[model samples]
Target: MSEPVVAVERLPHALDLPLPAYATAGAAGMDLLAAVSDGRPVTLRPGERTLVPTGIRLAIPDGFEGQVRPRSGLALRHGVTLLNAPGTIDSDYRGEVGVVLVNLGAAPFVVHRGMRIAQLVVAPVSRVRLVERPILPDETRRAEGGFGSTGTGVRSGTDNGGFPASEDREC
Candidate 1:
């Protein structure tokens, strides 16, 4: 096997701390977050955004991909999550890593620079080739529909099948 070619950068302010890395072999991703106040976290106002730095950028090799995801701790505790959760950083992208976070909880959270905001998981990617087709597949019970299109029906063994059987049921 050949050595993986990945480029990394340490932010000027990241002198005291080391760049994020995984400890175990199964750890395909590393936590990329900042250390804010003991509890306060970063907050994003409605329709507003701030570039929350991850303090590093990677040059993922071809045939590979980088998935930027929200750190579980941040999400569960603060309701702060990546606006574009699992955002893809393609191999060709050469930009400083940033997680676009949004505050979905009722209260605002404070985000300090150098705080760990998200994580980056690197994985292998396979390219799919497309072939032109004159006609598309015609039909099926759930074609082109979503959310609850299959009759909004209940599960096979469920009593009501997810739909009200009568008008008096207050469906």
Candidate 2:
């Protein structure tokens, strides 16, 4: 199978940095780099958030969307992650890609130019034709139950808002 080609243009500040690319053959996302001016670094204290620029514009084909997601290693090690995780880039958007990063750890985090701060996953977009109806199909066994509708480890008989009153609470 062939990969979809996405057109990209690097802005002036990003000329020295490489374009987003997969680190391995089996990787599902392309690493997005931080394009701070002149390869400069930006520091973020704990609980601080900033918009880190990618300095690149993309031409995502119609029927596809770009997803900006946090790197697991950064989140697990430093508690740094994208604020609006899995931020969506619409197909029609032709502007610079900026990552909204937040430091959730006790110490400060530094973002340098060419640092892999996030990943971009291009996914197919399926458009649906909405048809509103007063009534829908028959109810399923777990209809309308959200959140912890499924039972937790402790199997108590009482319904914890999610479980039905008469239903069995067994896991």
Best by TM-score: 2
Tens digits of per-residue lDDT, candidate 2, 1-171, equal 677789999999889999999999999999999999764699999999999999899999998999999999999999999999999999999999999999999999999888999999999999876653333345555655557865544333323435334433233
Residue 161 deviation, candidate 1, in Å? 27
Error of 2 at 109 (Å): 0.6
Model 2, poorest ten-residue lDDT window?
162-171
Stretches of model 1 off by over 4 angstroms after superposition:
1-5, 23-25, 35-48, 137-142, 150-171
- Candidate 2: TM-score? 0.84
Q: Output the number of the lDDT-best candidate.
A: 2
- Indicate the residue-level lDDT of 77 in model 1: 87
Output the worst ten-in-a-row residue range by lDDT, candidate 1: 162-171
lDDT of 1 by residue, 38-154 (tens): 345556764445667665667889998899898787778877888898889999998777778887766776787566677788888988765433333344455445667668753
Per candidate, the number of residue pairs that clash is 12, 0
